[model samples]
Structure formats: C-alpha cells, structure tokens
Target: MLSVHLLTLIALVTSAKAAISPFTSRPRLQTTFSGLSDVEPFSLRLSPDTAKVCNSTTPGTSGFITADDGQGGNNSIFFWAFESKHDAKTDPVILWMSGGPGASSVGYGNLMELGPCRIASEGGYTVDNEFGWNVNATILFVDQPVGVGYSRGQRIPTGLRDSSLAMLRFLRQFMTAFPELADRDFYIAGESYGGSWVPALASTILRSESRSSGQRGALMVQEDGPNLSPNSRRGPKINLKGIMIGNGLVRRSVQNIGFFETVCSGPASLFNSSQCLEWAPRAMWCEDNLAVCEVDGMKSSACKDAESKCSAISKVVVEDMHLNPYDFRRECHDPDSCYSEMRHIDEYLNRSDVKMALGVPENEPFVGISLDVFKQWEEVGDLWRASDEYVNHLLQSGIRVLIYVGDKDLYCNAAGMRLLVDRGLSWHGQPIIRLRELVPWYLGTKSAGLWKSYEPLTYAEVAGAGHLVPFDKPEEALTLINSWIHGRLPAL
Candidate 1:
C-alpha cells in the first residue's frame, strides 16, 4: 500500500546503495599531498589515533584527530575528508559543520548533507551522492565541540567560546599532521548554531593571525607576552579565504523581528490568526527583555532571563502546532528524531562494521544529536546573544561571508536571515547596506534562487528548500557553494 512517491523513493534509495559499497578494500587515511620538509614552531604530530580504509570508492581519509582541550587532557575531534576531485595541492580546503551546539557534522553534514555518500533511510547500506561538494574542493566534515559524535573528551565545552577554542586547537594540530594543507586556501563553513560558531572561530583565527609575524616557512604560537600587532608576533596562520553559512542563527534579536511575519503571514499560513495574535504581546515582552539583556554583560543573569523569554514564541509553536521547526511542509515526528534522517544516521554510524571502518570505538554508542549538550547550553544560558559583531569583524578585516537560507524553512527562514543581515550588521562603525539589488540566481535553465551582495557579505535564498538547504536542494547547493568559493555568482 505504499504510495507511488514512497515506492519511487525506496527504489532510488536501493539503486543508490548498489552504487556505493559500505566497505572498501583500499588502504585507509592515504594522503595525496607531497610530504612536508620544513618544520614550523607550532607544528606538532597527532598520535594515539587509529585509521582504516572506510571506503574504497571514496577518496581521502576518516579518523579521530587528537586536540589539546585547553585543559591538560586530549580530546578527539572526529573528521571525515572527501579529497577534491581536482588538484588537491591547489584546490581550497573547506571545513564543514552542522549546528546543534551539539549536532554531529559527521552525521548531518556528512551522511545527510554534502558528504560524498549517504546512508540509506532504513540504515542498512550506503549510497553515492552525485551532488556532493567535494567535486572541486576538499571537504572535511568535523564532529565538533566534543562529545558530539565519534569525538570524545574528558570534559564537554560549556558554550560557543569554549567550542571555538577547542576547534582552533584541533585545526592547528590537524594541519600539522598533514602539513601540505597548511598553505592551501582554507574556509570555515557551517549552519544553524554554526552562525555563532563560524564567526567566533573565524574571529579567533583572525585575531591570532593578526598578532603573528612569520617569515620564510617558519611560524610560532606565542603563549604569553606583551600584546603585539600582526607584524610583530611570529606564528603560523591559516590561509583563510571566506566562510559560508546556510540558514544560520546569526543574531536572535534581529531574527526575531521576522519571526511573527513568517509564522503568521508566511506563504503557507502555518498558524491561525488567533494563535498568531497571541504572540504579539509575547514578542514585545521578549523584545524589552532582550534590550535589557543586550546592555547587560555577556555572562549576566539578564541575558539568561532574555533567552528564556524570547524562546517561548518558538516553543509554543512547536508544542502546539507540532510542525517541524525546520520546515513548514512536515509535522515533527518525535522528540528523539528531530529531523527525518536522525535515526538512519544513528543506526549507520553505530554499526560495528561502520565504526571499525571509521576508527570509532565499538563500545561507545553514537548519538546523531546530543540532547545532553543541548541541555548544558541551556543551563549555562549560552543560546541567545548575537554573532553580528563577529560577522562585522570578519567583513571589516576582509573575510568574505555568505549567508544563505532556504525559503521554506520555518525556524530560521529567509525573511529572518535577511533581516539579520540588512538591519543587524555594521562594519567599521557604519551600518552595512546592500551593494547590489536582489536578483534571480540560475542553475542551468531554471531559476534556483535569489541573491544579493554587499562586498564581503552576500545573502541568498534558495527556492523549494528548508532549514537544511543542502539536503533539500543538493544540486543547487553544490552550485551555490562552488560559485561562492570561486568568487563568482551562481548563474550557470
């Protein structure tokens, strides 16, 4: 009694699985880069790690890379790399993350979004994703912030700041192990909570890079000294190019302005007028609380108070309407399964063979999304506040930033993202204004979306897509990414 569409989905899933075998005979963790000769001050080798050939057909590596946890202990940050189909030596290195504050990039970014392959819905096999983003650039999907996935650590990070620092340590060590990647053009990309994560990490890197002064092939990480400028301090630098964030939560205050618009008058009329009317008072109340929170220090109780008040709008919608916060077209199925593929990814990653192949511990269970991490952030009042400052910092410092959204998303909709960028951003003490008119973006013969640019900042909206833009519009997403990295608008 399966519907025609459902039957077709199963057939495609089965056929796709046949194309990509779950196990590969090729040696694991092989790198195509020419070996490093010169040693750098910050360079340190990663150890106590195990790796294997996880996929024969897929190129590049998958393993846990050890990073110093800022504490004495070492934390494992899980990574899966899809080496570029083009020249690995010159192509850009793109690191991807999916936001949950606790989400697994290996699960959401890899298995569900832009990885070279995907897990079958029932979780028994793997399938080739032709639209994977590794076509021209090396893509590394990292499970970050510790305790998110295959990554393990003695302590869990409390918030974005801690998570960003851990990631910085991990990146340094990871690049050192594969020294050839150090000089390549690097980019950080993520979504959702990653809105905060991407900019925070980018700012940290920029700050470090600015203070370092290195000549020839040597770099040093300064531990302590009088603060110096970029020309004075001598250390290594990540060859950062730009960042791309998909439907991210940039500034909650700015985004909240568009919340009522989307919920009440969105294309689908997802909420009744009576229900929508009830939110006006709550929205105003939250706004007043948020204003007070903004003036209060980052760690002040007022911030937590504001976070609690503003969060109710979405909470009530989720609790009462039962709509998937990510998309208006579907009902959220269950508490355990937030998105459609959560269960499938959990099953695929936890399989004994799969774990052995990827060098994950056999005993530790895999969690697609860690509710514990989520709760921890809530407890510490880390969810609210704004990332516009970081974004502005990046722009003023010449780091290109792209914010793209799926028009169908209910949670972080295009309207909200547009509001965040157009109204919420400022650079060099001046408010950011659009440099170009919003225009149709093309993918082949069809109009895929709309895009507008403001020099280092660009805002895009993808048609027929939801919160998880890449998963909802793979081909268009790939095209959009390629265009962004290549310094061209996606017109083809």
Candidate 2:
C-alpha cells in the first residue's frame, strides 16, 4: 500500500545514522543537575543492529530504556525513548501514551504507528519511514502502571479505575529515576482511552508542582479538602504547554448515550422493521433489527422464526458492537472480519524488539487482560470521566488542551468528540475559527480536510484516520503537532 514517492522518501531518510551515537560498551547516563544522591544514575545503550522501519532514510534502531521514579513505590519505571536523527538537545519531547488502561505503549504507540521506527517483517531490519514523528520531536513511548513494558510491578490492578493510582506511582518513580528530564519542555499526548490519561496526568503534574517551591515540592492539595488528599495529587507541576488526544474516551456518559443515538439511529432504522424504534429512547434495539434483516448480533433464537414483521435495519452495527459487554472481539462481531487491520498491525508488533522492551509478549493473546480485569474494568468504567473542575483548572492556568478525533473510528468518533468539547468548553457564541481546508499535502493521493478552530482550546477532525491518527496520516499529524507546539495554528 506504500506509494513510490513515500518509498523514495523512506530510502532517502533511512541512510542517515550519524545523528545518534553507536551502541557503546557502557550505557550513557547524561545527567543535568547535581545533588540528587538518593537516585541512582543510569545510561542507555540503543541496540545497534535494530532496523529503523518508520523512515527508510533515517538509519535508526527501535528501542532504548530510561530509568524513572516510581514515587515511593517498590517498582521502578522504565521508559522507551525514540530519538530523531535531526537533533536531540533542541528537539521537543513528545511523550506518547497509548489507550488501553492495559495496552502496551511501545506495541501500539511506537512500533505499529507513530514512533520513529516501525517493525519490518523482513530480517527485522529497520527502514526509514517518511511519515515518522521524529522528524521534529524526540518521542518517549511509555508503558505505565508498572508491570507494563519492561517495567516491573508487584500487582496489576483488576479494574480500569485504578489506572490513575498506577500512573501516579509510575510518574513518581519515573521522575526520580530520570532526574535529568525534570526541566524539559514536554507535551503529554495519546489516543483512545488515553484521552483520560493525558489530561489526568497533566493535572496531576500541575498539582504536584503547585505544592512546592521547586521541582521536588510536595503534591498539591485537591479542590475539596484539607486532610484527605484524594488520589489526584502527584507528579511535577509540569510546564505542560499542550495536550493532544486522538480518538479519546474521556467523556463517557455523553459520548455513549447522546452521540451514539444521533449517528447510529438513522442507520439502525434503515435495517430494523420495528415501529418501536423511536428517537431519543433510552434502550438498545438488538432483536427488532435482527428479525427484519440479517443484522449480525441479534441472530439468536429469541429473534428467529417470530412472525413479528419489522422494518429492515442497516447492516452497520456500531453501538451494539461496542457495548457487547465483552472484551473479546469474537463475542461482539464476526471474528472473521473484526479487527483484521489491527491483527496485521499486531503481527508486526509482536515480532519487534520495541515491543519486547515494553514487556509485551510476542505470543500473548489478542485480549491481553485477564477475565477478572475485564469485569473490574466494566464496573469501573465511570471512573475515566474528566471532571469540569479539572478542565477549568487547566484553562484557568493557561494550559492549551487540544482534543482531536478520527471520523472513522467507531469507538471514539468525531461526533462524540465534538459533543464532549462543546460541553466542556465555556465558549459563548460561535467558537473562534482558527483555520480550515481540504488539502493535498501528505503521501495519500486524495487529500483530506484539515481544520484549525480554537476558543482557548482547539478541536479538529483528521480525515481518513481511524482510532490512531499517526498510523493513518503520520506526516500530516507530525506537521500539525509541530505547528501547534510553535504556537501557530495549522493551515490546511
């Protein structure tokens, strides 16, 4: 599927490797500040033979491990930093987190999608990728919650709600381990469920910094109380310039109920024969649609052979597929067709050393989490909501929050994202229009539209991208991110 021009760009970029030092016999432990005796200094040795597949022109490897503060916890945080061939010292740091309160960052965020090096099926050699994010920034692909990636932890929490606690401990350990990065300008970015993690972590860092005079200050107090400091406070009061969430799941209640009905109801009515299908109803219609047409999920005997004539519903079953109440794709959709692209990406991910560094097993099952974890995740789904207070706190502090959505992703589509932004942002009247256009600039032949509109915060739709924007349009994504960081709204 890669074009000749893209392949040519890859070839051009793949041959350059002088930007990064060759693997040394000793690890490189470059520190910035002194007087941190409690923390042990460590160096990183990048695998020399590892191929750089993301950009064919930049000769680079896949992974490197960095030490981080676990924050009073016994576990140590280890992160994978992807360097750019352009320049390391001056390059901005883009910290990437993948969604999945339980997914591996290196697997999903790095090798398969955004980071500099992607996994190549041939000989494990790295190729240059023209669309890699490293053309402008140094990406730190992190696996949080301890037991993630190569980082070790005593226990994996059974529910998704425990993600915040895990991240707090991880950030503490991460900062402690890499005291050198304490003052770097950083941006927290992610996709899917990470919509929650990025903002929550940013807020945590801000609160942590607000407490003390210097970087090592005490955690900030919560908005509510004096003695009972909620699990919210922890981490550095980061000079967090901005945040980007692609296809995130931060506004759960509104997204699932309000947006779901609006976009899917019309399609559902086209396939279902039941007159019971009324707009704005607070119930799911699986049986009516199945009785009328061959809708996938409602084929059980309960809907079969019933002479209850119903209207034919469309074959598109987005909501039911998501709310199947099961983590297994087989339980939700036709296994033969469900996640075919994801499975291919997974195949490449399993074979990469980048994945190994993140502690994701090559042969691990598609549904990585245990059944107990899934059940707990369901019970605690509400915990992922980002409160109005937190959003307000950031805006009050002048932090820029950018929430982006991929129109094609059923799980966290643009419609849901728009609803969330409208609800959270306090903008009166029509939101300020920053920029907009359907342009042809990236590798793809038919160009996608790019819109940059802001009202203190900016929300835009990255056309043609799925749940993962970078994977779908890496060059455009990188360009947009670079423009935003530089305080310039992108012009489509």
- Residue-wise C-alpha lDDT for candidate 1, range 1-492, written one tens digit per residue: 000001122356553432211123332322111111222122121111112322324535666655446677767677767777667667888999889878999887887888877766666666778887888888888887778887778888877778787777677656644546777899999989889889999998888677655463322222122212222322235888789889898887778766777778855676688987877888777655665655774468777677777777677667777877787677875534666577788777788877766656679877777888888777776766578888989999989998999988867888788877777788753354544457899998899999987678878899999988889899999999899888887773
What digit string (tens of lDDT, one per residue) describes model 2 on residues 403-479?
A: 77665555566655766666534433124332232233332444454444554476667766766778767766876
Q: Which candidate gets the maximum TM-score versus the true structure?
A: 1
lDDT of 2: 0.49
Q: List residue ranges in candidate 2 displaced over 4 A.
A: 1-22, 26-73, 120-127, 157-181, 215-237, 257-280, 283-376, 379-389, 425-447, 450-452
Shift in Å, residue 74, candidate 2: 2.9
TM-score of each: 0.83, 0.65
Model 2, position 432: C-alpha lDDT score: 38
Residue 7 lDDT (model 2):
14
Indicate the TM-score of model 1.
0.83
Q: What is the C-alpha lDDT of each candidate?
A: 0.70, 0.49
